[model samples]
Target: MSRITFEDLEALDDDDFTEDNSEPMDEEEQDRLFSHWQSVASTHQVSIPAEMAGPIQQMTRQSNAREPVPFATLSRHEKLDEVVYEERMYPAGKWACVTKGEELYEQSISMAFMKLMRYICKENSAGRYLGMTVPVLNEIQISKDGKSFVRDILTAYYLPAEFQQDPPEPLDPDIVIVQREPVRVVTRVFFGTTTEETISRQISSLWELLESTEDFLRDTYIVAVYENPGIPCRRNEIWFIRRDQ
Candidate 1:
């Protein structure tokens, strides 16, 4: 297997991964894109909820005006093989989101991710085309099966800096753009192809690394994946949110 350097992963952030944002996709093109995305999902064994199979509602319009939101980094511990621990701060901003299984607490994170992708791909009400950003964030939970698995996930996409003030609304009733408060986080960078086994290992290592820290209050963590499926090298991060003392 080819090795993916951390530097390469960092470079991916600067790469353009979306269509022209100056003009949103028209209704017909939006439907085509959604249909293509659905076909891709089926090929991967992922299912799109029925409500998401059509054009999404747009509660607001995109004037195409944009202001860059500041994106920053953090401090890290020495690299321990594939895992590197880091402490960082994040300024909260607007996020395009889809959350399910909150009441039942049994929702699949994959579904939320699919729905959010739909919003970014111009399926939402305003037919906006938002560029893809790094670190697709997932609020993770250990499955009912325990530490051996991860489930009950909430997935989100960071709205591009331009829409930080008032993001275009999601057409899917279950999807919305909400502002998240600023937070301090500890993260472990996991480099490699992501699979359930490797992710579980990284999650365990994250807990162990956290346990060794002093004076840091932590209650939960999330996984931030930084690669597309076809990418040869990938960078996946497990983020532990620090609590207020």
Candidate 2:
């Protein structure tokens, strides 16, 4: 819904290796330099040059592990937990996420996954590379038609501890940085692939359990996937945001 303006293009420095001819950049070098910026722009659905595909793939591999947000499990339900998420101020940083999706769970999840991965491959406005982090969060909601729809899928990579003072702006519009205040939540962990029936069942169970409790109140819920897809056994959790007492 947003247009890439001349100023926007200008802001993203063009890869001009041919200008000086001081040894052309090789595949690895090209990826190190321009791939991040190209991927960032692409997250916003902006058109990029064909030559960058190779570098983009290279960037995907660079996405490894980073520091994750810390929390403590207050109570355990098999593999799941009622977590007391540590009260910490989430530093301002760009989170690559998609706000729309299809009605089906798998289809919608796949689309959101691609968008977030594209954001990871791209560089932010500051030209700094962000390391990938785990537990991609997907917020889901049920529609009036009695069908499940993904409200928004969020893949947030934590900015390094140093970026606490000032984080770089996202080059792409879809990747926006905002501060998150601390909150409490009840979470139910599960494994294997998530299906529509599974989601419905889980939502019902978490709500029922919460309603019986005296203190906890549900404002909303989020679906958190911790492992990469294709992993035969992946960890997933449904998080119910608890209202302030």
Candidate 3:
């Protein structure tokens, strides 16, 4: 099936597409359309106003309403004598991941997220419905140009405890289940929708704040979003892996 571009979605008319006489699309069709849109949106980059970010937020909220993936707090500290970041340890766990080479961080996220969403929603070898998990984690590699561009993004969803022992295989070849080892990271919290500019600014701020005292991997970092995109005061975070870990 051909992919649906962002322009196509914008061109669609609700009245014409959802006419009273037309039959509703089947679950399979719906999933296919959603996945296609996500694939297309991942390549399309644009700024979204807070009001216009609702639909995307709603989609994320529905998927993340389930229990959050567990993690442990190893330590907390202030940067430059101010509360800036924290250190945390996440245990080894299983995750469904999709990697995309996209120019923009947000675009890669939108695309990868829908793909992973399909897997947990029953597009797997077991055909079992594995519900969603909170705080979609995105590992992003910054370009050598000094954070001016993004090379790629690895979007991951932690598998729920029920399926962690024997997670189903993904029907999509691009999606995979992998075992992650425990690791320690330094993280900073932010709010609202994440755009290329906003994310870059946050990374720079954190980098500068910790530059003098900590040793961290500068090439890549993790972007974690914990709340529904549509809600106000949403929680988002940027995590830097500690080099000593």
TM-score of each: 0.63, 0.59, 0.71
Per-residue CA lDDT of model 2 for 1-245, tens digit only, reads 23444344445433332122334457886654454444334434444456545334444344344456555555554425454222222233434455545545555565555555555555565564555566676766655565555454444444555564576666556666656555466777676556667766777777665535544533345777875442334578777765562
In order, candidate lDDTs are: 0.58, 0.53, 0.69
In the range 1-245, model 3's lDDT, one tens digit per residue, is 34445455445443322222224456674554345344434334533323323233234324434768788887777756876888888889999999987666676776677677667766788886676677789887777877465657888999989889999999999998899988788889997657678888889888777755457887878889874332334479999988766
Give residue 177's lDDT in candidate 3 (0 to 100): 89
The candidate with the higher TM-score, 1 or 3, is: 3
TM-score of 1: 0.63
Candidate 1: what lDDT? 0.58
Candidate 1 lDDT over 1-245, as tens digits, reads: 12434345445532222232445667875665445435434433454565664323221122123223344566767755543677877787888766655332223555676677677768765676675666777775665546534434567778887667868888779887778888777877777545456666876777776655544433355777775432335567877777672
lDDT of 3: 0.69
Residue pairs whose backbone atoms clash in candidate 2: 36-123, 40-122
Candidate of highest TM-score? 3
Model 3 residue 142 distance off true place after TM-score fit, in angstroms:
1.8
- Provide the RMSD of all predictions against the true structure, rounded to 1 decimal: 8.0, 11.6, 8.2
**Steric overlap count per candidate:** 5, 2, 0
